[model samples]
Target chain A: MFGEELKQFQRLGFRHVLLQVLNFASVIASGLMIWKGLGLITNSESPIVVVLSGSMEPAFYRGDLLFLTNPASEKYKTGDITVYKIPGADIPIVHRVLETHDVVKKKSKRSKTALTGTGEQLLLTKGDNNEVDDIELYQGLDWLERKHIVGKVRGFLPYVGYVTIAMNDFPQLKYALLGGLGLLALVQRE
Target chain B: MHNIFSRVNNVSALFSSCMMGLLVAIALSTLLFTADPKGNLNIASVKVFPMKNRRVSARKQDLAFVNFNITADLRPLFNWNTKQLFLYLEAEYANGQGAKNEVVIWDRIVRRKEDAVINVIGKNKYMFRELSSTFKNVPPAHYALKYNVMPHVGALTYGEAGRTLEAVPFPESRERVS
Candidate 1:
């Protein structure tokens, strides 16, 4: 089984194999470029996110995919589902905006961009399935500011992100997948 | 050119792309299902009192208690794609400093079309308070019944169902209520 492929590899020579490696590397690089570029256009650190918890159940399951966009000029309102990350917390939470207070801050030229048609808005979020609001989850903070939020959820996809979750749960599967793809790329002729 | 590996790869590639196209079409088809349902919402009563918040430091915060009535036939909002409806009551007001606020005092999830015809005499399910932590000099609030339509797949949509005809004013905070 190895003899035929070894002969082909020898025939192709080191320079041809190196060129193939370059082609494979470029393909991966371009994929990353498109993902990061989309994130920039959407103004979300992560343009797409997978639901990892059941807090927002009946609407989003554990592996559902969510699309997000944060329009810098727009203000979040009550009932909009927002994906927010609290400081020191690694995972983001998806919950609905239960309260929005546009508190009047002293008008300073430096903070002008923070003010919308409404004053600087402060938000409180609550999971639909949870019994109470997310005050306890804030970690001593009273309210969630706009900065802590990743984005407002706009579109949803069902269970498409389970592939990533499956890979995460099984490291062996991940390595096997990566190794198989690498071997195939090396062995296959254009 | 016509090897077994290439044939399997071509078939799989075509199959995945077709599935993607079908999903996109289903997501876009929601735009054509234009449904705006209307109903009635009334504020039965509103009372306020100064109370200490124990979760944080012991500081007096004006807590408003509200009782409301809702009668909305939200069946029109449900379709095969609709997973559920998140219904909520929001209080819209402005403080003395002219800062606007919208707060959801109560909410319920309706998972079935049979349960979408809502008729309830309910009270605030969550704590209702102003950002300044006082209802004194806070303007009267307008109550609106809104809904978020969550789909099994595709974009989520929102709409209003009903609103109180008049703004409800918070009564002067009593030191204590018997």
Candidate 2:
């Protein structure tokens, strides 16, 4: 009995373990590759965003997935919607630029070297359909600089992000799905 | 034979459980930190009123004027510590070209529970005088007005407080359009 069982054990050992490891590695690699590809194509660290609110109703809705692109040398313009992250804040904002002012002041001879720029780009942003500009939202942060922007929204698909929202809202479903899929994968002998 | 099948089933169960545990960890992380996608703020009302205006005749035989208005009744997102707010108002023209009339509206700051408004003043020729800052020298056309209200080191209650009031155009006949 022992001799026969030892031969059968060979069928269950190294090959099965190696196959599982390879499958997991491939999944991880593909995810990284896609993220890198998106970064290169958009010239932005984050190339996609999901609309988190209804501030832009009638134009965009919640759960909509927005595709973003930011060329390295590009400047923003009026009516362009953008996503920007503020320092010390975990969430990013989505809004439209209403106006831009290029302000240049003659530098005084004494402090000329200390100033960051002779001119400052002052930006005014607002949500479409919002009655007021975004001055209140800036929290006295003054003007939003070009460096604060993450990306500009180019296109959007509605309600497609609901699955992400749902999975977050109810975590049990997420675990159940994973468990079911793993079981299915493991049960197949071939 | 039964023992062999039992062992296979045990291995499968263990694999599934481990996968489920990892998935749960990921989901927990997402929930703990990521911003909620369901958040939204509705703008309900808006109103604007000119605060100051000085109408004068230019030496070149053209009319010139400066006006400031205070906009009021902007409902806020929540009852948090508000730091500051910014606003921009521009005069638009129908032809979208150089019409002598100009209205530059900008807000310095807005406080909590306070009405927001921008001050504007400019002068143009009499023909252009009739042209409103709403746009270049065209009547019945409106100016593009936009604003944003952000939090400054403050907190916004998840879904209850940020509903803004809609903008109601000031009645043309009112003495101070607000």
Every model: Cα RMSD to truth: 2.1, 16.3
DockQ of 2: 0.03
Weakest ten-residue segment in model 2 chain B by summed lDDT? B154-163
lDDT of model 1, residue A179: 94
Isolated chain B TM-score per model: 0.94, 0.30
Instruction: Return the top candidate by DockQ.
Output: 1
- Cα TM-score of candidate 1: 0.94
Model 2 docking category:
incorrect
The count of backbone overlaps in candidate 2 is: 39
Q: Per-residue lDDT tens digits of candidate 1, residues B15-49?
A: 99999998888888888888999999999999998
What TM-score should be assigned to candidate 2? 0.48
Which parts of model 2 have CA positions greater than 4 angstroms off?
A1-12, A105-120, A182-190, B1-178
